[model samples]
Each structure stands twice: as structure tokens, then as C-alpha cells.
Target: MKAVYINELGGTDVLTHGDRPEPEISPGEVLLRVHASALNHLDLNLRASNCRRFPHILGCDLAGEVVQISPDAGTDLKVGDRVLVDNRVKCGGINLCEHCASGNDQWCARQQRIGVDRDGGHADYVVAPAINAYTIPDAMPFTEAAALPIAAHTAWHCLITQAQLQPWDDVLVQAAGSGVGSMGIQIAKMMGCRVITTAGSDWKLDEAKKLGADAVINYRETASISQAVREMTDGKGVDVVFDCVGADVWEENMLCLKPQGRLVITGVTSGSRSSIDLSILQGRPLHLIGSGGRSRRSMADVMKMVNQGALHGIVGRTFPMAGVAEAHQAMHDRDFFGKLVIEH
Candidate 1:
């Protein structure tokens, strides 16, 4: 099978597009004929970070067809089933552990990310646990289905599960051009929230407004985003702030939140190190929550909405599987909005 893999950790220079052996399925696993895979910032980090193995395939969001099922796999899925492979890998096998049993597999102590801790879907063929593959509607395109696993699920977990966004609540989403941020804006709007989002360029801000952001802030043009947000909200800050920009926007995020507001953070794309002023927390009584992967149930709920047309796929660009290096470079340069996908 042809695959994009990294033999050593570095930049795009280390990425190799060549043939590799097709992965074989284990008990409770199935072979997936990957049709499309989406790139996330995590792919970049993994490419540069130390890994336990060489020749690692980096991609988590995958849309594929089941080509082979293990005899021991207990599933109704058969060959030719179109499915979206969930990126979160549970600890125990098909027999669920306590965490996975409760739909909290993200917290499973032995859990691993598909692309990060194991070989992922950046190839023509990959293997996944049967339970990790969710069937998609026949009407959905593989490109769009490939875009949903990580960003959409993360946004749903952050805003709905963690932040508890309320209807008509004023919300601020940082980095509106990002996968999660773009999804956050749409989800908040769908939930009846007044969504305000920030981006570096006017073009991205305009695009964000089209994605349902009620107010758009061009951070590059604005000297103080918090002040701008305050002005937009008539002195009362937003009830919730969904920020993944990390240290670069941490202080501003604090300033943009209303008293007792919730701030849900899922990533630190702009460096993680930051200094917090304890006085602001004492004064405002803010809620700071950190989140990561969502549960399978959460992904199902979001997908149901997507299938129903309540939520839309946000695919910004598509690259052939061999052009993954270029896709990685674009993501690193922040040159696109929403998700970047690799078609197999």
C-alpha cells in the first residue's frame, strides 16, 4: 500500500511518500481502505516530536470503507461499509474497560491517539478497532466525513460538554480560522448563542462570519481584542470563551470573559507557557476547563446533526495523499481555514 510516513522526526523533509506493507487486522480489528484523511495540528507536532517507532503514519481523521473484518470482531459491519474511524483508541479490546464502558474512553489510562501513539490513516490501507469505526450516511462525501472525527468532536466536547454553553449566551471563540474554532463558532450559533470569533486576517474573519460568527475580530488590526470584545458586548464580556490559542491569548481570554464565565481550552497551538494573574481569578471567579478528545457518544451526536444538515463540514483544502508534505506546510503557515484533507 502507498503511504505517507516519517522515518525520522523533523520537518516535512522527513515525510516519505512511498509503498509500505498493508496492515493486517488483529482480533476485534478490521482492515479499512482509507479513502480520505484529514490533517490536524497534532500531525505537525507528532512529525517533529520523538516517537517510539520510525516509519510512522500521521493522520487521525479518516473516512474509509471496510474491506476485511477479523473473525473475532463482534460487529454488524461487513466489507464495503463506509465508516469514519474514531481517532481515540480505548485501553481494553472489544471488551470495554470501565472508562470506555461509561463513554469516557478519553480518560482510559492505556488509551492512545490513532496517529500519535499508533500508525494512523495516512495511507491507502489501515487497521482500526471495530468499535472505533462509525458508519456514515451514504449521502456524505468521504472528504467531509474525513473532516469530522477530530475537530468537530473536539468542538462539541469543549463547548457543549465542558463549557455548558447556553442558548442566547454571548460566546467568544479564539482562532476562528482553525478547525476547532470554526466548528465552535458554528456549534455555538446552532445552539442559539451569539458567537464572536477572532482571526488574524480580514479574509478569515469574513469567512468566519459566513460560518455563523455574529462578530469577527481581526487580531492583527486590533491592538486590544479584549477591549474590542467588551465594546461589542456593551461592556459585559462573553459568557463563555473557547480558546485554544494558549499563552498568546491567555490574558486576553481572561479579559474577554464575563464574571463567573467559563473558558474551555482544548489546545495550545500558540505555545503553552503562560503566566496567570491570580488577582483576576479572585475578582471574577472564572472557570477554567481543559479538554481533549470527546467520547464516542459525543461524536455520534455531532455526526447525527451533521447527517441531518444542522452542522456543515468545514473542509478548506484537499491534497492528494502524496501531497501530504505540502498540506503539512500549509497548516504550519496557517494558510487555510477549517480542515485540510488528504485524499487517498
Candidate 2:
């Protein structure tokens, strides 16, 4: 099987596209003929490992067909079924000791992830536990279904499960142009929150608005993020703040939260070193949350929305599997408004 993998932790040059051995599937596993996959910032982080066989495949989110299923598994479905993968993999499917049973036969006692830790969908084939997949509508296209897993799941986890965002609450979503950010806008709107988003450019802010952001900010234009957020919320700050742009914007994310408001964090795309003030913890009583992907239940719920046409993955560019390096460059450029999809 041909796939993209990091030979070492370094520049995009280390990501080579070529043939590798097919995955060795175990009992109860479903082997998918990957039709399409999307890129995420995790792809770059995985390459930092400098491992020879770091990622057998490169994506967490995938949509394709069930080419083969282990017969050893009990009957539930059959071959050729259209599906999308649930990127989250933890013990008991929810709120369990994740690391003890994550990513494999064993669980993650710490509740880890699948595509971020195991072989993923960035190839012609991938193997996952059957429990991690959901059926898409028969009318859904692999290209569209391919885009949902990670971003959608992560968004659902932050905006729904963790933050418990309420209707009419104000929200501030950083990096509004990102794949996660794009879905985040919709998720907040769907939850009835008046969302404010920050992108690097004016055009992306427009795209954010089209996706349902009530207010958009070009972070480059606004020197003070917290102040802009305060202005957007009528100086009261927001009920929730979802931040993925780490380190460089960490302090600002904290400053934007309202008194007793919650701030949920996932990725730290920028450098992770940042300063914080403890006084704000006591003064404002902000809820700082560190969140991972959705639970199996939440992933399924989000997928249900996709199947019902209530949710859509934002894909701005498509690249062939062979051009994984080019895709990395685009992600670094950080200009695209949605996701960069890789077709098999």
C-alpha cells in the first residue's frame, strides 16, 4: 500500500509518498479502501517523532467503503458499506481510563486517540475497530464524508460536551479559518450561540460569516484580541472561548473569557511557551478546559448530523495522495479557509 509517512522529525521533506506494506488487521477490525482523507495539524506533530515507521497512514478522518471485514467478528454489517471513521478511541467508549484501552486491544489509561497515535486513513487502506465507524447516508460522497471525523468530532467535544455551550451565549473561536474553526462556527451557531471568530485575513472572516459567525476579526488588524472580543460581546466578554492557536495567543484567549466563563483548548499549533497570570483565576473565575476529541457517543451524534445534512465539512482544496508534501506547505501557509483533502 502506498502512503505518506515521516522518516524523521523535521521539515516537510521527510514526508515521503510511496508504497509500504499493507496493515496487519486483527480480529473484529474493518479494513477500509480509503477513498478520501483530510489533513490536520496533527500530521505535522506526528512527523516530529523522527520514527522510521511513525505513521503507517497519515489521517484520522476518513470516508470510504468496507472492502473487507474479519469474518471472525459477529455479523452486524457487510462489505461495500459506506462509512466514516470516528477518530476517538478510548476504553468503555466514554469517560473511562483512556490510556488503559486506547488505540488497540488495550485501552488508553489516559484516553488517547487513533489516527493521532495509530495507523490512519492517509493511504489507500486503513484498519480500525468496527466500533469506531458510523454509516453515512447512501447518497453521501466519499469526498464529503472524508472531511468530517477529526474537526467535527473535536468541535463537538469542545462546544458541546466539555463547554456545554448554551443557546444565545457568546463564543469566541480563534483561528476561525482552520478546518476545526470552520466547523466550530457552525457548531456554535447550531447550539444557538452568537459566535465571534478570528482569522488571519478579511476574506476568511467573510467565509466565517457565511458559515454563521456573528462577528469576525482579522487578528492581524486588531492588535488587541481580548479587547476586540470584549467589544464584540458588548464589553461583557463571551460565555465560551475555543482556542486552537496556542502559545502565541494563549494569554489573549484567557483574557477574552468572561467572568465565570469557560475556555476550552485543543491544539497548540504555535509554540507552547506562554505566560499566564494566576490573579485572573481568582478575580474572574474563568473555567480553563483542556479537551480532546469526541467520545464514541459524541462522535456518533455528530455523524448523525452529517447524515441528516445538518453538518458539513469545509473543504477548500483537494490534493492527490502523492502530494502530501505540498499539502503540508499549504497548512503552514495557513491561508486556506477550510480543509485540504487528500484523495486516494
Candidate 3:
């Protein structure tokens, strides 16, 4: 099997493309011939982190055709089925993991992530629990399906599940150019919300508008994002703030929200540490949320919407399998507007 893997933790220089041993499926698992894989910020961090096992493959979101399945897989999925993977793998036994028994498998203490904890789909083939594979719509392309699992699922979980976003709400989505951010704009619009999104570049802001953002802000040019947001909302502030960038925009996000607005954070691309004015909380009373573990059920909900054509994956660019290193470099530079995919 051909794969892009790393033997050491450092820069993109560590990524190597070559043949590796093909993974075999275990009981309750399936073998997939990966058609496409999507890149995430996590891939960059994993490449630079020290704790990763040597010869690790990096890709968390993937779409593929099922090639083989264990008889004990207990799934409706069959060979040749086109599917997108949910990367979170939880301990299965109800008696062994209380979280799985309670249907909060996202928090299972024994959970293992595909790319982070084990070899992932940056190869010709990968093995995953059958339960993590969901069939994608027949009309969708593999590259597009590969882009959806992580970004769309995270956005859906943050907005619909954690924040309890309502259709009438005025929403603010930070980092309009990002995978999750772009998806956030679409999901907000699908719910009939008035969306105001921000990005460092003007072109990215334009793309956000095409995704149904009612207004867009160039954060690099804007002297005061909070004031701009207030002006856009008639000085009332937004009813919800969906933020992926951290510390850098924390204070402004607080100011841009209505008195009781919800602020759901799913990532901290910017440095995480920041001091907050405790008095702001005392006076405004906001619902501050952290997107923790995402549930399998939320991934199912996202796929249901995709199957209905209510949402679609945003593919900013596609790289050949051998271009994984170049893709990593592009992702590090934040040069793409949506998900960067590697087609096999």
C-alpha cells in the first residue's frame, strides 16, 4: 500500500510518500479502499508534535469504497459501498465503557481517533470500525464527501447541538475562510439566520457571501470588529457567535455578542491563553461554550442533511496522493478557502 507517513516530528520536511504495509481489519471492522482524504489543522500539529508514533499517517477525514467487511461487523454496509468515515472510534462494549452505554460515546474514556491515535486514510487503504462508516449520497464525488465528516460535523455539533442556534438568531462566524467556518456560514443560512462572517482576506469574505453570509468583514482591515458587527446589527450585537479562532478574537467576540448570546468555540488556531475581564461576564451574562468531543449521532444528523441536499462539502483544492507534503505546506500557510483534499 502507498501512503504518506512521518518518521519524526518536525516541519513538512518530515512527511514521506512511499509504500507501507496495508492494514488488516479486525472483528467488527471493515477495510476501505480510500478514494479521497481531506486535510485539517490537526494534520499540521500532528506533523510537529513529539508524541506521535514513528511512521504515523495523517488524515482524519476520508471517503472511500468498502472493499471488505468482517462478518461480525453488524452493519448494513456492504462491499463496494461508497462511504464517508467518522474518525472517532469509541470502546464498543456497554459493560466496558459507561460512556458508550449512556450514548455519549464521544466522551468514552477509551476513545481513539483515526489519524491521531492510529494510522488513518492518507493511503490506498485503511481499516475502520464499520459503525464509523456512513454511506454518502450517490451523486456526491469522493473528494467532496471526504471534506464533510470533520468540518461539517463539527459545525453541526457546535451550532445545532451545543449552541442551540435558532433560525431567527443573528449569527457571527469567525474565520470565514476555514473549513469549519465556511460550513458554519452555510449551516447558519440554512436555518434562516442572518449571518455576519469575518476573514483576514477580502476574497475569503466574498466567498462567505456566496455561502449566504448576509455580511462579511475583513478583520485585517477593520479597526474594530465588534463595532462593525454592532453597526451591522443595528447596535444590538449578534445573538450567537461561532468562533474557531481563539485568544486573538476573544475580547472582540465577547463584545460582539448580545447580552445573553451564545459563543461556541470549536478551535483555537490562534494561541489559546488569554485573560478575560471577569466584569464582562458579570454585567452581560453570556453562554460560553467549548466544543468538546463530537457525538456519532451528530455525524449522523449531518449526513442526513447532506443526503437531503440541505448541505454540501466545500472543496477548496485537490492534491494527488503524492502531493501530501505540498498539501501540508498549503494548509500551514492557510492558502485555501475550504477543505484541501488528497485524491487517491
Task: Please tell me which predicted candidate would have the highest lDDT against the true structure.
Answer: 3
Q: In candidate 2, how many Å is residue 321 off?
A: 1.2
Candidate 3 least-lDDT 10 residues: 91-100
Model 1 TM-score on a 0 to 1 scale: 0.96
Which lDDT tens digits does candidate 2 get at residues 73-131? Answer: 55376898998887665554334563434533233455445566677787888887787
Summarize candidate 1's per-residue lDDT along 46-128 as a digit string, tens digits.
88886667878888889999999999888999899999988887765557778777767767766887887889999999899
What is candidate 3's lDDT per residue for 287-340, written digit by digit as tens?
Answer: 999899999889888989999998989999999988998998899889779999
Better of 2 and 3 by TM-score: 3
**Local accuracy by lDDT, each model:** 0.89, 0.80, 0.92
Instruction: Give the TM-score of each candidate.
Output: 0.96, 0.90, 0.98
* Candidate order by decreasing TM-score: 3, 1, 2
Question: What are the root-mean-square deviations of the candidates from the true structure over C-alphas?
Answer: 1.5, 3.2, 1.0
Which regions of candidate 1 deviate over 4 angstroms?
Answer: 92-98, 101-103
Could you tell me the lDDT of residue 309 within candidate 3?
92
Candidate number achieving the greatest TM-score relative to the actual structure: 3
